[model samples]
Target chain A: MKKIINDPFNFVDESMEGILAAHSNLLKAAEGNVRAIVRADAPAAHKVAVATGGGSGHLPVFLGYVGRGMADGCAVGNVFSSPTSSQMKQVTKAVDSGRGVLYIYGRYQGDMMNFDMAAEDCAEDGIEVQTVLVTDDVASAPREEWQKRRGVAGLFFAYKIAGAKAETGSDLSSVRTAAEKAVSNMRSMGVALGSCTLPTVGRPTFSVSDDEMEIGMGIHGEAGVQRCKLENADQIAATLVDYVAEDLPFCKGDEVAVLVNSLGGTPLEELYILYREINRLLTERGIQIYRPYVGRYACSMEMPGASLTLMKLDDELKELLDAPAETPFFVQN
Target chain B: MKKIINDPFNFVDESMEGILAAHSNLLKAAEGNVRAIVRADAPAAHKVAVATGGGSGHLPVFLGYVGRGMADGCAVGNVFSSPTSSQMKQVTKAVDSGRGVLYIYGRYQGDMMNFDMAAEDCAEDGIEVQTVLVTDDVASAPREEWQKRRGVAGLFFAYKIAGAKAETGSDLSSVRTAAEKAVSNMRSMGVALGSCTLPTVGRPTFSVSDDEMEIGMGIHGEAGVQRCKLENADQIAATLVDYVAEDLPFCKGDEVAVLVNSLGGTPLEELYILYREINRLLTERGIQIYRPYVGRYACSMEMPGASLTLMKLDDELKELLDAPAETPFFVQN
Candidate 1:
């Protein structure tokens, strides 16, 4: 494996150490728990605390979002593995204010189980905690089974709206409502040109022939709905956009916040190309784009692919989306 | 080659179209010249314009930096090729106010030739233009011959400082001096585990064994000073830091800004891990880090590697670095 890591076994720990060192001004390890990272000014009084956690490979996700206007804290885990409930509870306690905490994350089995358990643990300590699982990958399930779908890049929308609500001193239930609304109005799909290698595995998680592409692949290399000969950017964009837009039934005059996210190895230039096609198609369909973000917001480690996310926006959602946010990985004004 | 692109010959044009579509609020193609991109609010009266460009494929480098408090315009070129002098001249004219324009880019032969010709072209048109060629890759030349070195991630430092200076209404000479000083005090070196493929080429630019790495490789897959077995992140960090530090002869009390830039395929998590080691070694050497940035600030399309840049800063550079700036690819407050 051509990874620049000291020990594959310590990849998660070492990476967490590095994250803290580089972003010392913005983040800090939760007191007494290295696996839990919190904003340096966490536990602010009377504000609803927002927290998320998941596997470690996706930077700017779980940990990178913990800052002033985003998640107040995040529990971290090993590569593609969920953080322990203990870690989650510790993070919950670290960031919880008098208003309580809201837990948001992708709808993976391991993640759901851990966060659920942590919620129960926090309850015993009189710390109110609510959960909102993101289910926005349209290809992972039919419309009737949307709750079964996995979360993808659309989680960023959830983070933004929910974090913005919590930052406004909303209660835990209000924050949970905003997060659920964000997830309910979102859809995402991806096309993977190549596989990613987990540091621990020391090899690619999966493989694809040179001329093939996998559509709707999961962030952790989960099986996609289709595998076919590689296609050009326009075709790929059409496939992804059609699936996501149709799932949401986005219509003429509807506004959206578009995220053309890189899946690790895809360059921003390509993402913009995909975004161009997406914009053209959406415009043709008469859908209005309120805001468009193109970059690596979420990613698998070194996977060559891109994902498209469309979050149908309402006035409240738009206001929240446009609210100022500052984090190591993301900042907006 | 598994890249999400249309006809190879149309890659640059298509990507530029996408960029204009996604960032129309912040940027627009220059009138009468699609290959020249300018800020939507370009030609701000009496403000010295800052512009930079080179070969394509490096996102957020040339065009992505054109926005408020950064570059005012940038010339676009085909992948791994310099923009024509005509295109540069058009962009210079598009952004220049009464104060003048500053041209900054890497010291590649094609870039130098084209930019020099463009400067002359602008002179003939009575639009004052000054040039500051970035030479910061310590591995490309010895200290005595630093002017012959190639630019790398350190170019971002030059952009930030000079852009900030220009945004403050500095004159052409002042902006030029800030850019030159930034280039003079900066050093960078990279290690590539695999080569990046140009869209038009449709194949890897160069090849390396899975167990080996090339140190100090250029953005376009140019040869480095050494090729050896792949080393751990700490060892790689030490080698890169040692080379750049020794070249500057950075003193024990020097304060510097550090950038751990991903060469496309390397994930931010790995860059942070690399940054951790870099921080340790620099601190051990008594070099204090002022501002640290770790991300894909500069890239060679999907190449599996990273580069380290150190910009030794004085009070002026520090103030300029801290100035607020907002662009599609970068934002600071």
Candidate 2:
């Protein structure tokens, strides 16, 4: 209940309003539809357009990535709820530049169904559409059935690489391939010390004892793999890294882009503390860190937790990720 | 006590270690002195150097500002404690390129005393040192005694302007004037819904009842001007903006830059929600928003609150603010 919002029901729309208002030069509402946002110069001619969408609350996920060298458009959903197929179709049609559209989003039941419907709807208009469902949360499924897993912070990697590929005037198939490559090589896991309340709910989504932490918790407070007593930063880093690295069996020589993402309430200082340990443990294991990103890339609504994501990178992905990107929430040079 | 840290006393040092490890290309310890960090390419031949330092918990405050177009060096401090005069002097000498050094930091007693001492020591070495104490927190003092007010997030503005001036090869006096101008035009105030626990203390710095909130609370949980029941976002924005704008008496048709900074724990979504309202109010008041920044530009560990800052802009300030700057924590293009 302790949140700075006007009407709980207007949370998503109002947040979108704030974003568009702040970054009008970089982003805009697609054809006056607040639910469908696209880059200001969205339908770039002959360039493969990358579109993404998901439930709200995770800023910089779907909408925050809508900009040059990132996703071309985003269908914004309600807080922790999927957007409608109509909204998704609007974004798809708005950003399609005759080069086709590529959909990159988290692997959630509601999202999968909605995005699929949007793709089918776009097909009738002759706008070729491809989907890459990011399933990189290792704890959500066994390694053999990784596609059934949930996507968490690993969505960032898929977007970065896929968006870069699309920006290079690549064909839709190539962009989709780059996205799929990122999803296949990524693994993420999180530990929640607290839960965030949905604005409409007016209560915490879940709870953890004052002396405990839950590992593998979903962004929506879904059941985590285990509940354990609170541990120090290094111990927490080791546990999360072990779960992530072992899932990919990220070998000794593998290079990775590490993202230590704050779920919502954790401070940047703690993320760095966690990152230092992750850097040490990975170096000890002979794995090189290609680039380390530490901040709130993905989040629950003021939830107290941090997730660690590792995306094994090849030369292609390295170039793609290093490409400049500018968005309302993310900027790189 | 819910934090990710090991050996609370080692919190500052470890966090600094993490920063160095992550950004070795842009920052490095001065002469193996971890407490004194300078830009990787410090003493940029004949350019004026900017040296800033304060307590450690506020990431991206002093240390985070050291970079190519920001502060050239910083002396690290323990959580909520000032760095020693000796450490400050080391940084001053490390970054000085025979052009001189400008000292910019908050108007805190400990910081003032330490920085003054450092300047005195550096003066013995014939290194000209100028100081500008940021006193932008309008809630901290009456306008008649603005010099006694505490500096909060306004430090970012001073750094941006002063750093840009120095990058232009301006002499020390001109660089100091730019910082002073920014400090004079800026006003900031904050509201706290919850408190952050210092690692060594292992408890909330201050407590607010679950149903109550404090307005104008300091970054270190210092007393504010008011405490009342929780209010909605628009009302909160109205109060904060009124204080900031009226204090400067920001006139009609005046263009200004707005910074909506999270203390730490507040989510970016909430910050944007607040920004949307502030933008509406400013527009209604005939005030123009030049460049709006909504994020954790300054933070207090994991405190749940936010501060609003308004800096009236002129052509000169606008040009300097728009100039490019890159650091470990901030990047402007």
Candidate 3:
């Protein structure tokens, strides 16, 4: 992969600097630590601020969600790695009001350890912290072991719903509950047509023959449940939707929001093409789509493939999803 | 180029069908002709309607701009090809109210021919028509012959500024002038890291060595003015910015809107990396960046590259840009 970057050592920091500079009015570094960033108007009085963090390389993830009606602060780590507990602590303190804070991030061992340490540290400072780890990738675990599933694009829903709930002046527990509900109601699965290279490593993360695709592949190139000859867009969509829909066992009357996300290098045109098939299959199955989002919500560098995420929506979830949000990467009004 | 598409021949129409299905509330096909699309509430009484069209590959370009505070309708063609004159006529007629209509599109021989034919046909129907051709690619022609240059991402500014002007109930002439001003003030240049394949062709549009990058390439893989070994983000940004800035002779203290657009396959992370350096260079030159837009704006299929656009802004342009606009692919509030 040909990446347009500077020194590999400076990749993450430079990218963060670029974001801070471009959106100075909307975001700011926490006490000059670029790794710990918060919304410009952080610690909004009487509001339960939401905090999130994860590795870099995923634009619009980790840091891009820090803004109005989304995460208030984010602890950014190196590419595909966890942020330091100190950085998480800085973000927690920077965004926390008297109402407390919530940490909602993808489920990863490194993130779990770091965020847990940060939470424990913050508790000693008289600040309450709650966490709702996102584990919506169905391919990561069987139904009986869903808790072991890793998070993927479903993190977008957790942020939007929980952020909107927090913006309503809800208590930390209420916001955490909303996040948990979103996390439980969503399912995601992805396929990889090609691999991405880490800037410093200077290599393909994994190898896949040009004529084949790995279905249900993890964003980090983890082994997938299936690898087969490449299929057309319609066949791909049908296979993905079936896996996700069946996992959720979404009934005929269920109304849901659909997200056809580009992992990285896939163009918007292809996403829409896939969406057409997905929409048709859903309609055929008598499932109504309340709203559809087709674009790059989360990515894995320049990996050439896509992911499909479906979130079952009830009245409250629908209202929260409809609420206004303005993150650096996502905006819904 | 492994594209996720079925029936390469059905690519354009299927994609259009997908867009309509995903955004039914925001858009609709004109008179059941999917090739001619219009805003769901097009033909606003007493409002001068703006229409645009181009090939299919560039999302948010020809069709995505059709919505509130933007173009009223669009005529979509095959990949990197022009919409037929009849398709343009369908769009023109569908969007025209008692008020006149204006055609704002890129400057291409085929597009010009088709749009001219459509204009003549619309004129016979008693609807006044005006046009503003976008010619912002500085690499295509010298300053003295700028009118001969091809259009690229500058089409974005034209739709935004002119579309907002029309939304204010401005006459066709007034809207045309706004678009013309935008076309004249902006300059853009691009660098391609790799080629894209037309679904039907099943081959790369052009070739670039793995270690090379082509500078000043057109959206359709037209021959670039220069090709060199791939450089780091900073050097690439400097090269593109210098070419765009010197062409406009954009002076110190000039307030401008900066667009660092992904041609297609470049990842968002790399775009920000490029934006950081571009922003710094502009600041060092005493040029004020009024607003910055990064990410995929106008694209060239799944081509791996990016383009930088700088539009010198005046008070009128600034106010127009700030006007609220909502489209399937773009939104400003």
Candidate 4:
């Protein structure tokens, strides 16, 4: 109930204004739509324009990835809400480099409907636009119904691979193929021990007993698949690891890069603890780790949980992962 | 009192062991000193060696900086405790190429004494070593007694500049000078709204009322300069930003980098809120920002507070920041 903002309704917009001001040299505001964001150094010479959009809370994820070797542009919505079709169309035009634009976003209702409409709008304007829904979370649905699963942190892996191919000036078909490769090889599952409340909503999105943790909570405070008595770090890691392994069915000695991410409020101690167990589980199965990143990659606001993302890294994927990138949200080498 | 460690006494060691295992391809355990960590591909032909070390909790600061274009080696101590002199000596020996070693660490009594003794030990072993301490918090004393102020996140900025120079194979003296330059130009001030319980101690380092926050807190849950009633984000940012600006005597048209770091439990929303005020305050002074990083850079186990660091950068600092570097912890471009 207590905050210093001039208006709670304008929190996201005013915050973006400040962000653009600070990064004025590297970022710029899109014309017309307040929520539309594009790279200040846009139209990077004939490259396929890779654009992503989503709600705001999981930063650097949707917008932070808009930089060299990554997303070409981003459509940012209010916190936990999807951007309008008008905003999406603006991004489609802003990132267009005379080739095409690929609309990449998670599988959520509002995002799907608005982005779908935006695609039609772009076509009407003679701008070629293609869409790809990154639904890599295997916990939400069976493999046969993978398209219905919610997209989560694993979308980042797809973005990196696709963006690299796009930056190489690959045609839309090749870029799409690369993105699909990354997404198909990726799998993520999360467990929320607690929930996060949006800034405007002063109460938590979901709730569980202090001793019980839901095993498959969506990143946007969506209903979890199941809940059980709390378990130890090793047990939790084993649970998620087993699910991902069984779903993906990677053989022994397969190379993978692991991401053990905190949803928000979990401490580093807990992440490292989970990382320890995850490493043991994977190594015991003869998995070869290319690089292990155990930190908050994409976090829900104040949510107490962790997700495991395993991407089967190929040479191209490795190259993209190795690409040097910088943005307000994520910096990588 | 709940944690995920097997034994409280072995928490740091076990954590280090896990880190080594996860990073073994990039780092290794020093032969004689388990506390010292060296790059797996060390003694990089003739580059000057850069080594850093401090207590455990302020992660990604001392240990995470050990990679290409950063510290070549590091020594990690127990929670809020300094590594032994032997560990520092081992780190120096491991990193020492023919170009000598530069030692950079936060200002702490135990770390200072131990590193000094280690320098002497390295001297006996015919290895040259130089040292620089970051003590930039102004609230500990006025400018006349700046050295008495404890070091905090400001040290990381020093590390970036110094490490960049070291990566360019600068002489030990040049690297030391750049580090000192960064330290001299940097100023940081922090407040603590809560405390961090040491893993072994199993109790909070200090207590705070539900409506209070301590101003000018150091990294290791140390006492702050003043305890005051809790205020909104803008007021807190104003308090911190005013202190940092006044300490630096920054003027119009000055270009500086700002870091708003969360001390653990504070969410990104709060950090961003704090960041909004910081940029506003600096811009009002006609200052231009080169970079603004707001997140958990140096977290202290579940402690609730935010620290603001402002570094008036020179062309050289900006170039090094623009340089490409990669490590397990941070990647900069």
What DockQ was computed for model 1?
0.82
Clashes of 3: 0
C-alpha displacement of A15 in model 1, angstroms?
Answer: 1.0
The sequence of per-residue lDDT tens digits that candidate 3 reaches over residues A23-116 is 8989999989999999999887789989999999888787888888888999999999999999999999999888999999999999999999
Q: What tens-digit string does per-residue lDDT give for candidate 3 at B1-333?
A: 488999999999889989999999999998899999999987777899999999999886879889999899999999999999999999999999978898998889999999999999989999788988999998898899898899999998989998899888888888889899999999999999999889999999778998999999999888889999999999999999899999987889999999999987888888888999999999999999999888888998778889999999999999999898899988877
Ordered from best to worst DockQ, the candidate numbers read 1, 2, 3, 4
**Model 2 ranges off by over 4 Å:** none
Clashing residue pairs in candidate 4 are none
Residue-wise C-alpha lDDT for candidate 4, range B1-333, written one tens digit per residue: 434445677777766766776777777878745579988888767898888898887777778778878788998888888999989888988888878999888787899999999999999999999988888887777887777767888877877788789888789899999888888888899888888778778788788887788898777877778888878777898988889888877779899988888887676656776787788888898988888777777778667788999999889999877676666677776
DockQ of 2: 0.77
lDDT per residue as tens, model 2, A1-333: 778889989888888889889999988888799899988997877899999998899986778888888899999999988998999999999999999999998889999999999999999999999999989888788899999999899888888999899888889888899999999999999999988999999988777999999999998888999999999999999999999999988889999999999998888788888999999999999999999998889999688889999999999999999999888888888
Candidate 3 docking band: medium
How close is every model to the real structure, measured as TM-score?
Answer: 0.99, 0.99, 0.99, 0.93
| DockQ of the candidate models in sequence | 0.82, 0.77, 0.74, 0.37
TM-score of 2: 0.99
Instruction: Assess each prediction's global lDDT (C-alpha) against the native.
Output: 0.89, 0.90, 0.91, 0.80
Per-residue lDDT of model 4, residues A185-236, tens digit only: 8889898887776768766776788678888788887776778887777788
Cα error, residue B45 of model 3, in Å, equals 2.2
For model 1, chain A alone compared with the true chain A gives a TM-score of 0.98
